[model samples]
Target chain A: MKNVQRIWTQGVALFGLSIIVGIAYNTTRIVSVPWIAQPIQLVNEMDRILKPVYEPSIKNISIDIAKQLVDKNIPFIDARDDEYYHEGHIPHAHSSGDLIKLTEYLDIAVGLFNPFVVYCSDDDCGSSEELAYQLQSEGFMNIYVFKGGWKEWNASGLPIEITSNE
Target chain B: MNKYIQLGIRLIVGGLFIYASIDKIVDPSEFAKQINNYHIIPFGLENAIALILPWLELFTGIGLIMGIYLEGSTIWIFLLLISFIALMGQAILRGYNIECGCGLKEGQMIGLAKIFENVIMLIALYWVIIQPKKYFIIFPKTELEE
Candidate 1:
C-alpha cells in the first residue's frame, strides 16, 4: 500500500510537470500563427486542447423550424455525399455538401439572399453542423442546421426526392 | 526468465509508448474528436486530456526505456494500460465502431482485438513492474542494487 501511494504521488507530480512543459513547448512553437487568420478559431469545447482562441458557436435549428422554413420556400442545402444525395433528398434541396460540389454551387449560393437550411442523412450525422460551420467561416451568415435531417423528414412522410441510383 | 528478457520488455514497452505519443502530440484536435466519440465524458474535457496525455506518455516512455524511475514509471505504465483496457472494453460494450485511435491513426475499430492488444501490453508492463533485476538502469543505486 505504501508503495502504491508513492507511485500514485509520483504519477501525479510527473503528470503536472508534463502539462507545464507541454504547454510551454507547444506555445513556444517555431511559428506563431495568429488566431484570426486561422480557418477556424477554437472556442468553448475546443478551448481545452486548442490554444490562441476557442471556436465560435454555430447556430442549430430544430426540425419543426426546418419544416416551417421548407414551407416558406427558403433554399435548402443537402450536406451529404453524392451517393447519399442521389439516393433520396429533401424536395427542391440543392446538393452542396462536399467541397467540390459546394464550390460548383458557390455562384448560386453567394447570390442567394435567404439563409441556407442545411441537413445531412440523420440526427447523428455531423455533416450538417460541419457544413454550417464551414459556411459561417466563408462569410455566409444566417446558416441553420436541420438537426433532425433526412431520416426524420423521410420518416415523417414529408416532401422528398427519390433519385434512383441503382 | 532471463534478465535480458526483462530488458527486452522494457525497451519494447517504452518504445511503443514513445511511438504512440507522436501522432497524438501532433494532432490533438483530431484526437479530441476521437475521444468525444467515446461518449464517456460529458463536459468535453477530451481536449484537456488530449493536450496533456501525450506528454505524460512521452516522459513515462522515456523513463521506462532509461530505467531511471523504474517502479513509479512501470506502475504508471500498468495503470495507463489498465485504463486503456477499460476504455476499449467500454467502447466495445457501447458498440462504438469508430476508429480505435491507436498509435497508427485509426489502426482499427475498438473491439475485442484492440482490448486484447492492450491486455498483452499490460502483461508486458506488469512483468517490468515486478522484475527482480532491471538490467540497464543508470541512476538510483538503491533501486538498482536492491
Candidate 2:
C-alpha cells in the first residue's frame, strides 16, 4: 500500500510538472514563431494524407501517372532539399524545394497551365504535399503529389540523374 | 546475479526514450499528425499529446536512469509500452499504414513489424519492472519516511 501511494505521488508530481512546463514552452513557440509548424495545422493532416479531392487544383497521383509524366517530358519538381537533388534525382526533376522561394521556382520551372508532379524522399516526408499546396496557393492548377516519392522511384530502378561526380 | 544488471537495464531503456524524444521535440507538428493517423485519440487532444509527450518521455527516462523515482518511472514506462502495443496493433487491424512516430528512426514503420517492435520493447520493460531486487536506488525507501 505504501509503495503504491509513493508511486502515485511521484507520478502525479512528475505529470503535473511536465504539463506546466510543456504548455508554457509550446505556447510561446506556437504564438510567435513564423517558421515552426504550429499544432493547429496537424488537425487535418491525416485526412489530407490520402488523395485530396476537395481541391480541384491539386491531386495525388500514382507511380504510373508519374512515369507517364516523365515519358511525356512533362515537368516534375523535386520537393527534397538541394543536397538530395544533387546526390541523385529523377532523370529531369527540377529543384523547387525552398519553401520561401517556391512560387518563384514554379514561375521559372513551368507555366501556370502545365501539369507536373512533386515528390520528396518518400511517402513519409510531407515536403511533397507541402510543395503541392504551395503550388495550389500560388494560382497554379494541375499539381499532383507523387506520395510514393523518390524511394519508390529509386527502388524500381528507374532512370536516375546524378549532378555530383562519384 | 549482479544488481548492476538492473542499472544497465535502466540506462538502456532510459537512453532509448531520451533518444526517441529529440526529433519529436523539434517537430511536434509531424509527430502530432502521426498520432492523428491512428484515429484512436480524439482530435482535440492530439495537439496536447504532441506538446507534452516528448517531455514526459524525457523525464520518465531520466527518472528511471537516475533512479530518482524508480517505482513511478517504471510504472509509467510500462503503461507507455502497453499503449504503444495497443495503438500499433489497432492501426494494423484497421489497415492504416503510417509511420510509428517513434522519432528515433527515419521512414515509416508500419504493419506487423511495428507491432512486433512494440512487443519486444514491452517484454524488455516487463523485465525491468519485475526485478526481484533493486540496487543503487536513489529514492528513499517508504519505510525511511517514518
Candidate 3:
C-alpha cells in the first residue's frame, strides 16, 4: 500500500514537471501551438487584404447546392484517399489526395478565380473542410465544401464515375 | 551478466523514448492531426495531448537513462505503452487506415505490427520493473545502494 502511494505521488510529480517544461518550452518556439485548439473558421482573414470586398472564400454547401454546381459543370475536388477516390467519385471531380498533383492539374486546367467544390467520404468526415481550408490558403478565391460528401451523393443516386486501374 | 543486461535494456528503452519525442515536439500541428485521426479523443483535446505528450516522453526517457526517478519513469512508460496499445488496437479494428502518430517513424500506418512492437516494449518495461538490481543511478542514492 505504501509502495503504491509512493509510486503514484512520484508519477504525478513527473507529470506536473513535464507540463511546466512543455508549456515554457513551447513559448520559446517560433511556431508555438495554441494551448487549446481554435475552432475551424472557414473565413480566411487574408481575404480582407486580398479582396477588399471581403466575401467568405469557402462556403459550406448542401447536397442540393452541390448538385446544382455539378449541373453547371463546375469542377469538383475529392479530398479522400486515392483508393477511395478511384473506387467511385462524382464525375469529373479531381483528386486532392496528392496536393502537388492536384495543384499542377489545377494550374493548367482551372483558373484560381473559378469556383470549385471539395468533398470527402461523408458528412462526418473532416477532409472536405480541411481541403477547403488548404485551398483557401493557396489563394483559391471561390471554394465550396460539400459537407454531405460522397456518401450523400451516392445515396442520392447522383451520377458517379469509377476509374479503372488499367 | 544479469546486471549488464538490465542496464542495457534500460538505456535502449530510454533512448527510444528520447528519439520518439523529437519529431513530435518539432511539428505539433501534424502530430495533432495524427492524434485526431484516431477518432477517440474528443473536444479538440488532441492539441493539448500533442503539446504535453512529447515532453512527458522526453522526461520519462531521460529519467530512465539517468536513473533519476526510476520507479516513476517506469510506471509512466508502462501506462503510456498500455494506452498506445489500446488506441492502436481500436484504430485497426475500426478499419481506419491512418498514420500511427508514434513519433518514432514518419508515415508509419497503424497496424498489428505496431501493436506487436509496443507489446515487445511493454514486456521490456515489465522486465525492468521486476529486476532487483539497479545500476549507475545518479539520484535517490538509497535505490542505487540496494
Best by TM-score: 3
The predicted structure with the larger DockQ, 2 or 3, is: 3
Each model's DockQ score: 0.29, 0.16, 0.55
TM-scores of all models? 0.64, 0.60, 0.81
Please state every model's RMSD to the true fold in angstroms: 7.6, 9.6, 4.2
| Model 1: DockQ score | 0.29
Listed per model in order, the count of residue pairs whose N, CA or C atoms clash below 3 Å is 5, 0, 0
lDDT per residue for candidate 3 within B1-146, as digits (tens), equals 87777778889988999999999988887788778767688788888999889989999899888888778888999899999999989877765656788988866878899999999999988987887777767765544335
Off by over 4 Å in 3: A42-62, A72-74, A79-81, A96-99, A110-118, A123-147, B143-146
Rank order (by TM-score, best first):
3, 1, 2
Tell me, by DockQ, which candidate is best: 3
Candidate 2 runs further than 4 Å off: A30-166, B141-146
lDDT of 2 by residue, A67-96 (tens): 777887767888776888899999888887
- For residues B1-146, could you state the per-residue lDDT of candidate 2 as single tens digits? 54666778788888888898888878776677667656666535766788888888888889889877777888888898788888878766654435688877865566687668767777877886776666666775534221
lDDT leader: 3
Better of 1 and 2 by DockQ: 1
